[model samples]
Target: MKKRSHISILSAVLVASVALTGCAGGNSSAGGNNASGGSSTPPAQTQPSTSGSSGGTAAPANGGVIKIATQTPLSGNQSSLGDAIKTGAEYALNKRKEEFKALGFDIQLFPQDDQADPKIGVSNAEMLISDPDVYGVVGHLNSGVAIPSSVKYEEGKLVMVSPANTAVKLTEEGKKTVHRICARDDAQGPKAAMYAKNTLGVKTAFIIHDKTAYGQGLGDQVKMQFEKDGVQLLGYEGITQGEKDYSAVLNQVTAKNPDIIFFGGLYPEGGILIKQAREKGYKGYFMGGDGLDSSDMIKIAGPAVEGVVFTSVAGDVTQTEEGKKWADEYKKTTNKPLETYSVYGYDSMNVILNGVLEAIKANGGNKPTREQVLDSVHKTKDFQGQFTKVTFDDKGDNTNADVFIYKYDKEQSNFVGKAQ
Candidate 1:
């Protein structure tokens, strides 16, 4: 097998850039410091050239079918986010269809709606893994759903790469088949807490979660970080997800007069909480994790969500030159502006597809086994895609990951200004 050193090459480049920037002793401007690091020119987006002819290994006697499955909530409250994941994955597959066809394989996408429910996600996983053609999956947007579903994938030796699952436990469980392209909540939570204390100047905070694995885990991470930073916690609560009214919780939170309110949940409940909190006279800053990154937050909260800030595991891809091109293509293809996780979805699918190609090459153009594909993915390093350079650690977490903060700008009618 050919050994690649792209991961080391990128790491050295980043280190040298940081060293040079430090020697200059100049502060990065707003546009220069977009995310966790100062802006540096990104490498051009071009497919890596393939080497060798299809010879050594046994060629597939006949053309085969390769299917990539996506499990997300295509209906229910989180459908907006689910739809973005589906669109992003589908876009990547569609763009690469010709390439796969040239390799004597027909690539197809099978998207299953899990409704953000663990049981439903597990069922989807069972169905996907049962099909021999379904070699990999690109989804399960919710960590709660992903955790259970990934178990089934592991049992079946099917690779499951996530674009949006941020909970620490997802990658920490030591499952080789489970991998994520996004930063973990532990990394994201501290940045958000620091922003609250130093940037927002919030002295006290009230925290709430939706009681799911993603929500509760992220909320705990933020809470721990905030307490360490000397921010007084007025209250910490978990509410039922589908409840229509939250006046009782808002009344309680308002009584404490917190300087900021942080909800560790998705847009559906977070939006209502913000709206009701504003209506009940709690004029404080609101913050959340990537679960609240969807435009639905603003749509549901209306004017109340103006100036609301959230931390996303994925940064603003549109800011980068390559990202702008990708954004244009995505809009032209999907007819909708790319959401926060859409780039992540695109990147995740590319990672899997890249691994599949490598696996095929390693087998000398023969149809590779599921285990070969899994091994190829495990060896991925510095696999550049539209979102960012991906290099998964031993724990299946992306080592180059960083959390970015974005604020909803009512005037601009969009989220602007990425902050570390």
Candidate 2:
């Protein structure tokens, strides 16, 4: 088990950069200053483009399978997450397969398990690139997977819509090719940091990461925000993900005796670490990013997950109108509820298809070339999504989305949204 502090420090730098910019102007939106648009905006109005029931203008039959690839953690420590992603995408495709057929095309989803490792993610991305049929991709649940995987897709002119990857740098430069439907780590990190400071009233905190790119990046972001708010950072460090035992790290966190502990990583490691922390007599707020929001965490942490807090970008997407319909239909078709990245995965399909549909209409229903589809995705603006408005800035990130905070309610056996 190896731990490096470099990524943790990088996250701190991310916060400092935002804070310094704030000093130049009275703007507070830089480092989590409550920028969630007040709920005055009405739900967005983008409609599905299914063909008319009657024999309407049929799309020119291309008779080719359009592939949408995914790189996820399907069979490793992160399999829980990978499974969610695959299910979500399939749900979306199955629901809308007819719509695509009506448009004279057949769309197929291609999933690859990256196992939450960067090297494997890159390998998977290259394999997808070699496959000529893959027009767009839907995943790489971990930010570490998304960051590098994106480079290959971008060079290959493939549209990438990330349902869960949320690191800031992924879309920082306004990438035209890579689009993310979920909020980024910077968004989630600041929201969690603010909750700890203003809502939880925590004065000192211990921040830790799993030493992976995503974990360390989020840990750094939270630490920087805590420091900006003048909260005492008792200690900050990194841990190795997938370690059998975290007793040594738990011993250190317990000695610090901080009011809260912020972990930046996924469930398999988080579940075990939180359980160990509680067993070792550390009673404080335990929190992490969306990676720790899965039901499996409760299974692993057992009673220890109770009262633990976490932030998620995908706010129980089933709560939205479109999400509800999709869940109902998915269960009717597959007898399962939408979970994890399902909302994001489905939403990604809607967005990419929306772009594809619009592109075909613009070109008079001719078979759209990959370049046309790529161009269409770039022009996506103000499309109504399952959870919220699905518009991207030049950086391939959502424009006005909110991060939600949830606490583990043992009584409910799930993370319940706190009444903010």
Candidate 3:
């Protein structure tokens, strides 16, 4: 896959690179302001990231430079999200650069491109683990990519703060080294299932998967939940990735006259399926997870995406005080629109910086070792971030964070947040 030098050109290959490599050498760097310490004047309208690691016994009052390694697809199929995640993360990192310096510390992110493949994701995790300068890591946009890659970080004793990975298994077993800034697929699956059964009042639902781990896992969860809740399971099927025609599956699905259809897959294929289903006159509501939450899905599915429902984390940050500020600066800096996971990227980076700054303070204005940084992250509590009030549960899931249901309004060319 061809790697675009600018972050504005979004693609899955770039995201794949992110899923696989951490801090590996990449396309030319995009340079920007890197001054450290608090500035007398805050940029107009934008409050710098208001994040602090509260109640961590490991962090002290003194501070110094903390290194955070971040991995994302900087060059492949999922680059749209990878680029958005990077842009938001960088914005937060820059805004708070001065604050950390005042506390006696500086922060830097060693970004790697993973290409969004699971194998590459694992490789990226190993690379970050090998870097003694790296304190903690953030990334792997796809749950399929995160599931295996996270194991490496767990063994390395380096905490992995995921900005977008939603697979339940990543944290459900109580992996202390893993923390997710978003809601899990299990929760989202049930949320969507409930919406289908109650809101849409669907009696029969057709479920399908793209055969990827993320695709199959969420599909199975929603399928089982729907059946348990007394909804008829019309048919369940799996489709091969990158295939051109979905008519075979859609044909069977249409024959079932299901009240709704659920696809557990990313936007690329999900969009195509929605388009195909519409062409076949299968008019029931089509639904998906965060994987289907993208502007491009509308283009791919055309008018078919209209009324399509999907779930997301952090809602729309542009609607909140802190969210609006970050959104404006992100647009200003990257000269590009923010996507679904941008706020998550911003929050995840803040989480890492909070721990890093605290660790440095505890160390008396000296650079913190990687293990010290990890300890700081584990000890973090009640840290407030721009998008959500963050406090990880015993399972490493963020507590009290809100998840949103979104409907694609094709005429408006955007996702309209819906009440669940």
Candidate maximizing lDDT: 1
Off by over 4 Å in 3: 1-66, 99-106, 411-420
Compute each candidate's TM-score over C-alphas. Answer: 0.85, 0.81, 0.81
Clashes of each: 0, 3, 38
Local distance difference test scores for all models: 0.74, 0.67, 0.67
In TM-score terms, which candidate is top?
1
Instruction: Please give the lDDT score for candidate 3.
Output: 0.67
| Local error of candidate 1 at residue 201 (angstroms) | 0.6
* Model 2 accuracy (lDDT, Cα): 0.67
Count: clashes, candidate 1: 0
Clashing pairs in 2: 166-185, 174-394, 174-395
Report residue 333 deviation for candidate 1 (angstroms): 1.3
Report the lDDT of model 3 for residue 29. 10
